[model samples]
Target: MTSTFTVLPVPLDHLFSPGDDINSIVIEALSTTRWPDESTGISDGDIIVVTSKVVAKAEGRVVEAASRESVIDQQAERIVAVKHTPRGVTKIVQTSHGLVLAAAGVDASNTEQGTVVLLPVDSDASARQLRDHVIDRTGVAVGVIITDTMGRPWRLGVTDVAIGSSGVHVLDDYTGRHDDFGNTLEMTVVAIADEIASAVDLATGKL
Candidate 1:
């Protein structure tokens, strides 16, 4: 038998605001959005991947600063590298959450003008809360992943990566496993969370 999975984008029409309940909003949206089989609800083992921007917005992480640089400085724990491009100087730094991202994940898109959005205070905690809420409301065990888009160190384009996750195995360890040819794998740990996030991003696009 062939194993298969699906990626469904939940259409949320309501704008996220400060102090909004994102879990409830997501549940309501799922209730309204029809599945491929015409089902109206989530199922067990379903993985819900969410964008970090919405989570940050709902958590009141938006701020108006003198400049994006200032916000980046405040959020960055340590500077990793810097690059000067035609656009401007791009600083890749490790944030307080230990995420090494360009501009410290200080996003200035899809928000009010002159305001930027920061990453959630604790993304893993946020994912756990959402996962718990889903189980509580729908009685379905689901995995939740909060994602953000970032450019790879040597890659040209950006891709979504998991910054937070819950109710899911974040990594698949094949270190001690043997291959079909009987070659023992020494160091093989796949980041399944980030893979899921990247797949979801392909469907959701850059939001």
Candidate 2:
């Protein structure tokens, strides 16, 4: 791992639509946009963090739904829990993609009226494809992480978490390593991908 890293948001002007090539779009943005330090172009170790919403949109995952609940029901593999709040009923479900998230990863925000966006069919595959595209275009090897917003089980507020990753080690396991104090460590694995996702979210803001 590097001692330091930089987070750069790829500025995009066009709204993503179904059937759009996300790899081309992202590469173009990175190629043309000037960085904060006046640098232009991707580096070898840069990790491209993309919001899953855009990936879903590009994959034609948007669906017209009379109610988001209906779509959630269709996407959910199993209902994990349900809660009745003052606002409405909230369902925590495991999606068909094996992700346990609220509303089965169905998003209704920042989309056309009467439509909601679904999570990518296979986020890991999506990440791999994007990583391949970046390498092919620039001859620079970089990691890719696809993220989605989710509320923690016992935590307040929502944050971005990695749903798919490629060209990156998602976990840093230190289960049998020793600490600085020479004490044997156990269960010290870190979710590096999720941490990167949250950090990128801070830089990019909401999609």
Candidate 3:
């Protein structure tokens, strides 16, 4: 059978507050949004890419808004690299999650006037909980990915990448696959989670 892929961006109508149940909010959003058809809601094999900001908020991973430098310092384990931009000095640091990212994944945007958001304490666990609760509520087997924005080492702009994933095959291994020329393929593993996260980022924007 032939196969096709689709990524649907679910928009949240309500401003999420700290300690909200993410699963309920997501299910509610799905309930309200008009899908392509009645049967076209979430289903098995569907991948839900949720921004980590919302997940963090729901988990109460936030603090009183502080200066960007201070927030970065608090979250970063060590500075990996730094660049002086016109706005200020930009630092790429290794976060507790072992991710080398800008500002150590501390975000001030889309947050309350006096608060900032942090990465979920354990993104993988967060993803698992979301996946389990969502499946329980809807009876639809779906994958969940918690994503965060990061700047590529050599890229100018930023893109969303998965920090936590659940019920999803994060990698596609094609090490033994054959090529059209009948040659054996090796060392070919695709990072499916990051790709999905990046694709959804285009729709979500930095806001």
Q: Which candidate is the best by lDDT?
A: 1
Candidate 3 weakest lDDT stretch, 10 residues: 31-40
Name the better of 1 and 3 by lDDT.
Answer: 1
Q: Estimated TM-score per prediction?
A: 0.95, 0.94, 0.89
Model 3: lDDT equals 0.84
Over the full model, what C-alpha lDDT does candidate 1 score relative to the true structure? 0.90
Candidates 2 and 3 compared: the better one by lDDT is 2
What lDDT does the true structure give each of the candidates? 0.90, 0.89, 0.84
What is the C-alpha lDDT profile of model 2 across 67-133, one tens digit per residue?
6788899889899999999998899999878899998988889778889999999999999999998
Please, what are the lDDT tens digits per residue for candidate 1 over residues 1-44? 24687788887877788999898899888787567777767888
Q: Rank the candidates by TM-score, best first.
A: 1, 2, 3
The all-Cα superposition gives candidate 1 an RMSD in Å to the true structure of 1.5
RMSD of 3: 2.1
Report model 1's TM-score to 2 decimal places: 0.95
Per-residue lDDT value at 83 in model 2: 96
For candidate 3, lDDT tens digit of each residue in 1-207? 356665566787767777787788788777654455545567788888889888888888888875657878988999998999898788889988899987788888989888888898999999999889889888989899999988786678888889999998899898999988998888989898999999888866775
lDDT of model 2, residue 206: 79
